[model samples]
Target: MNGYRFYTAASLLLLTALFTACQKSAPAPQEESGVNAETEIIPEPNAGSEKPQLTVAISVDIAPYVMKNATTGIEVDIATQALPGYQLNFIQLPYEKLQSAVAQDQADMALGVQKFKDVEGIFYSENFIDFVNAAITKKSANLKIEKVADLADHKVLTWQDAYLELGPEFEKLFAPDSPQRKNYVEVADQSEQVQQFWDAKDVVIVIDRSIFNAISQAKGHKLSEVDYASIFPEATYFKANFEEADVRDAFNAGLKKLCSSGEYAKLLKKYNIELPNTICDSKAHP
Candidate 1:
């Protein structure tokens, strides 16, 4: 009986030793490798920072201001020079539809918007471009236009939406309700308007001085041959209307810099236009 007990104890000791050896010799759970096998997303260098893009509504397409390509001209040159930091995305609209773009929130700002009337949500920038408008005629016509009322007696030609732009007095004389409406003609193309005057097809054409000068001079016609009736004496201004005040303020600051640096004059000369009145000289305050 004693010998049987001794044999059982020896067998138990051998089994315990074999289990201990197997645990120590095992691969030790691979030491975890410290590497993450799951997929990870690495961020790009400039993932969130990007240039600001401004969607601009440009309606002025007249010669010297805006060209047929909708990209080159005085307006474009001025915009580029003034706002060098922004990426301007220009969307060409008609003159009549300029303010509607900002009113409807279709664009951030409307460039060259003629301030005929005030829109509700739009904020105007400083008077950027001075558009000298007048009644042009061949010197031989000998037409005397002392005021806007004198245009009622003759067949008058002007740019699109001129009745609204001229004044309430002019609108009263030649608006849709006036009998003289039949005699008043509105031309979409100022170039064509100037050509009609030179061609003797139209006796009186009201147009911007710069545009008329640019077009008439381009046609090899001398300014001496024509008489520009300075009936509209006020310097009409075109402005940029914005939906946001900050953006408008920024544009004003930029415009002030452009004017102060003498870059504005260079742009005007490059476009073959010497505007009569400008904010450049007095814009140092801005």
Candidate 2:
């Protein structure tokens, strides 16, 4: 009887061990396993990964190159067509503030910088456009101001923040006694100055030729010609940060393609701008 009981206990122990082994060997239930079990190995979500975005900055004041149309508050059709991959954001800053904005990373690029040497930590592409500076006054004033130095006794108005070298020239000719040669009243913007000149015939307004022409055409104002041409020889460019070499390269490639294909000429014509041959000769033509 004792031998039989020991055999029964050993047999029961062996059976329990086998049952535990079978449980351990059983396959786990996979939540994703279905008709297509191969697709169960899905990739894990990566929170750190993201697509890179390119940003470009431009000024809002330079007409034709940049301007706020009555229909569209801000127009960037040229840039949009040029840099299709970039996400463009115009900062609408003043000319003086544009350089600082790009340097401080507030903007990735600045458009309409005529001279590359003037800005630091920024790389400029080839010149796209040229501008001519001119003086405007009422038709009745009939001001015969020829050279920049000729506006000595007359009250002149120009953009306040602009670097108007002509002001100093006028001061040297007129107000030698006054410190800083206080010659004319500087206003915040060209439009304001032009309006001032319009209201007060005594004041003379100095502005860019393209702007003067557009304004005159739009408002039916008469623009008189000065003897001297204020055409700047340097061409304007799309300025990018020094670190953004790739973006600059892409833009240059696109611009070169556009120039070669005569697309640039089409753009100029679309804006009603006439390109002068003097731009290629490094000389200013009237």
Best by lDDT: 1
Tens-digit lDDT track of model 2 for 1-286:
9999999999999999999999999998756536354565667778456333544555545455566731121125545555667656566666556656667787676665444355555666654445555656565666676576556567766654433333445445535464434656766555555567667855567666665566556666655532323433332222434336676676667666666667766676777765454123445322
Q: What local lDDT score does residue 125 receive in model 1, on the 0 to 100 scale?
A: 91
Q: Write the per-residue lDDT of candidate 1 for residues 44-79, one digit (tens) a residue.
A: 879346557889888656888888666898888777
Residue 36's lDDT in candidate 2: 57
Give the RMSD in angstroms, all C-alphas superposed, for model 1. 7.6
lDDT of 1 at 21: 97
The TM-score between candidate 1 and the true structure equals 0.76
- In every candidate, how many clashes are there? 0, 0
Per-candidate TM-scores read 0.76, 0.64
Model 1 residue pairs with clashes? none
